[model samples]
Target: DFQTWQLAMYCRKAKLKLTMKSILEEYKCGKVRLVTMLEESDDPVVKTVKPSIKTGRKWKVAEAIDEAKECLRLKEVIGQTQTDRKGLGSSSVKWWSKTEGKEKRDMVIEEVRQREDVRRIQKAVQQPQQGQWTNWDSAMQRSLTWKDIWQMAPLRIRFLIRSVYDLLPSNANLVRWGKKDDPTCPLCHGRQTTEHVLSSCKVALSQGRYTWRHNRVLQELASVISTAKGQSNPPSPSFTIFTTEGGARKWCWRSNTASNQRKGLLDGCDDWEVSADLPEWDEHPEVIRRTTLKPDIVIHSPSTQQVIMVELTVPYESRMEQAHTYKKEKYLDLT
Candidate 1:
């Protein structure tokens, strides 16, 4: 029935007419539908038969109109579905598609493999070193305190220990090398080494003669012995010397009264005089004599008169000048 109406509409719109029976035969064979023919038809009869239009055997004219509306709605829904699916597609897919060839993809994969290999090698190398243990703890365990380390150290290590200890001390007097000031020993003009500066320096030794002489005087007075035999007694009048250089030396001495007097003055007298500290007299006493002076050593006299003084040009320029001026002024004042 729907096909019959469709054919009738088509023939009318084309300004041609065929029998209704032929149209009915076309409908039975499912050839056409009311909406299609209506859209195509221009005939007045077909337009007037719109109320009788049939879309299919199941749909009347009214139902066919509703079915047409449903078809349009389905088309709109399908169009919307296609748009949404386009939106959900991966952005990467579009970007990749724009690429000219497979060359870029292969390059990216190769770079990733190289990076992974490098990381794997690095991890393998680091693992062993990270797990390895150092002998630091065992070495530390062998010595308790730093002093113990120094005491037990061999000759080579002792020097290192001394240097380390000197640096750690609050009053350490380490020399700054390569300074503009003179580096020679002021007393003897010898090259200044640490030992020479502090202890064994010939200049210092010369300056210290008076002090050593005084100490000899005291040793005689005190009746101290250098060593005792068959008495199980340790040596007396023993001395320890630490040089600025990395060595220490010990000395023991015994003196008689005559030897004491020859070295300086009376053994027990507190009024012992040396070349550096002799008081001015109206006439120079024959008993008092000048001694050699050096400027790099402190001669400690441990006699009744214990004396300690530096035997060097003072290190600081400003202070040395000031001291020189003061001494000159004092001498003039005395004169």
Candidate 2:
């Protein structure tokens, strides 16, 4: 009867049929105890010793022992209570105990203190009036001088003064009546200002192509310097436009007309004046005539001594086709 009961309990717990021989082998291996086996067995001889404890339609003793073992294994692995098992019809105990709660609160407070310290340091670093000439306003005040105001003015101040001169009639007119509302350029009928006249005016842009060319040349020069010396600190190129006899007359004529149009105390003066005269070359003097060039950009190349000349032209499709044909013909002639 004990053997039969053990086989029945084994079948119920394992959810598989257990032969009497397999049950005996497992019992000898000490996997199933004799007492547990006898308690869960359905044999009449075993039931007479202790009536089978049965809650109707609930887990049997064998099934309950198997579940308890599984729960214990899970608890060991995950450090959780068997009663807190999900989908098991059990209530949970609080996982976060008092000690865990205190540790979390301490971490939050430390993070807040760290954030406050960072903000305070940032505020100290960003405090204004901490250094002389640290900002644009202070730099301007420190750079201002009597010589700058009168004769050898800084570039920015000169630009501003020139702008005022171009806008108002004269210094006298400016003193008499702050500044005039007229914003027309005296040299051209375009809008007047340092930025507009020098950078964006159509007439100025046409004349400024030389500036782009000069920039390309400077870039090439820097590249050559870097290659030869194995150093990156190449000096910047100075842009100076020397007027040749051929272009000088034309420039003077234009300047005179512009002066006459303004007809004010500060009208007849040209803003751009260079002390150095144009270089003389008797062989090809007219071919190498001087013109004003402003540099738009500068870059460095890895090869060549003479800077590469890069001309930017927005040519029409027909003009481009003609240029291509001309080049092809020239190559054919050379061949």
Candidate 3:
């Protein structure tokens, strides 16, 4: 079983057919050496080929083809003539011409590939060992095709393949394999699974490790918003101040609140304020409401009287929906 699973992984990585399916395809295409020789020879020994038995390498090409057809779940249909159809039964299996068979072969193989992919995913979902990947379908919004994988770096490719399959030697795996006596995390003494080590360690959370990482991401985002705000030009005022000629000239600056020249949040405002609730960061927007909610980042346009609040979250893939629901509920009153 281990060897079979290893071979399947290699085939998946290379995007190639499994051994049995490849052999079946070769026979169908008339490329198998034994089948070719059998079709060409007229000797008594060659004519004595029998059906394959369960436990031996010595098998006829026809038997192998039959086994593969069964494994792939391709049903056989028998043809019946109009006069024979009334009597109700047909013994002869339907056969396609060479040209038509090639097209049908491609279609059937394509369908087999799709079904194989679905089965592989379902098996992964049912596996209790890899609990982190249970919500793979929902977590992955966009997946890389073969074209994208081929261009990635070797290190990135290796990491992607290993991480997805839970092949890395985490503490739990080490203990399971008898390499270690303890499976608890070194920092928090919790079960040292991949998710715990990566994101949920209580000691790491208290030590501000997670917060530091979150702040780093938030800082980059704030910089981008600040740059865009600076580059945008603000709209002109709706009205200008007028003064009568006297001994001294007088002018005043006034903003028209009920003017129709207002633009969007980003436009009509040269002074855009952006703040982030990060440690050691000085720019933080003061909360006017009676609440202690500090969003990760805040963008405010005083000219348009508009404000936007952003919250950052980095959770395990399986817990994404739960985290989103919690955030929405927590901020429900403020919104």
Candidate 4:
């Protein structure tokens, strides 16, 4: 019985059936030979022969069920992997063989799992925590606002915000990517970061780029203001001074622009020396140490005895509201 059962298993595995017809065919016993000897006197002894093989329909049914199960399993693997029967990256492979289903399934499952792991890791890296941005100091100011940034042409400020400039290889990016031997800023020997590249680095500040940029605009504004004052031509902004007689001041610019322009654009009537009061923060190192109230673009008018305070800020477009509010509140009393 066990042998018969094992034979049925073999048949099922090979997609064959064991039955009387198959057994007869296997043994070459299906046909009986008719002897043609002269039979009047002697008849050959008849040999007993019979088709004895018999099998139930259950084996065939069982075979069908096994095949159906294999098909269902392959289908499930294909669905989970979102792969064709031929597999991924194989243009000429048209289909999979049932005999190697397990191997193919394992390969595709591993590929899908690896792909999912990479996707999850990427998502985690791309989106950072919302709290990291809170209470953030750009090393520039605590009062930075979006409106302040939009007050000027956006391209340069946006460049700073994006940190896209060609920088020294010592920066954080190259260091993190293992391209650089150091993560310290070459300019200041500080940790190189976006903030350091833009704002926090002392060496970058020492380059006088910030002052140069601010003064370029200031020179243009001074020229325009001079024109409005009916001094169609004025001295170089570096040393030019407007004298309107008043006890109070309206505006004053204190900068290092006085180095080289003394002989180029001086005017006979342009005053180079006048009394001015700077905002507390900018007055002097001594002033900042003494007072906390500070203003930007301070103006002193001796003729009217009045002080005009102006505040300027640069922030991203998104922080315009905060920038405006901070400056307005800071100067509300003077306004």
Off by over 4 Å in 1: 1-180, 209-335
With a 3 Å backbone cut-off (N, CA, C), the pairs that clash in candidate 2 are 211-294
> Judged by lDDT against the true structure, how good is candidate 4?
0.41
Question: Which ten-residue region of model 1 has the weakest summed lDDT?
Answer: 131-140
lDDT, each prediction: 0.36, 0.36, 0.59, 0.41
The sequence of per-residue lDDT tens digits that candidate 4 reaches over residues 193-260 is 66465455787678976555545555554445435434423533543345567845445665564453
Question: Mind giving the per-residue lDDT tens digits that candidate 2 earns over 255-312?
Answer: 2333234233212222311111212211212212332332122222323222222223
The residue-level lDDT of candidate 4 at 312 comes to: 50
The most accurate candidate by lDDT is 3
Best by the TM-score measure: 3
Tell me the lDDT of model 2 at 228.
36
Error of 3 at 243 (Å): 29
| lDDT value, candidate 1, whole model | 0.36
Report the candidate with higher lDDT, 1 versus 3.
3
- The best-first sequence of candidates by lDDT reads 3, 4, 2, 1
Q: For residues 1-335, write the lDDT of model 3, one tens digit per residue.
A: 34224433533322222233344333333422344355445676765764232333553445544444454444333334344124555354333332243444543444345444555546655656642354543464334556766788978865554555455577997897789999988898889987776688999999989888878888898888878888765676655676768737656657665354545557767777887786655565555233577777788777676777778887766677888888778788866
lDDT of 2: 0.36
| Better model by TM-score: candidate 3 vs candidate 4 | 3
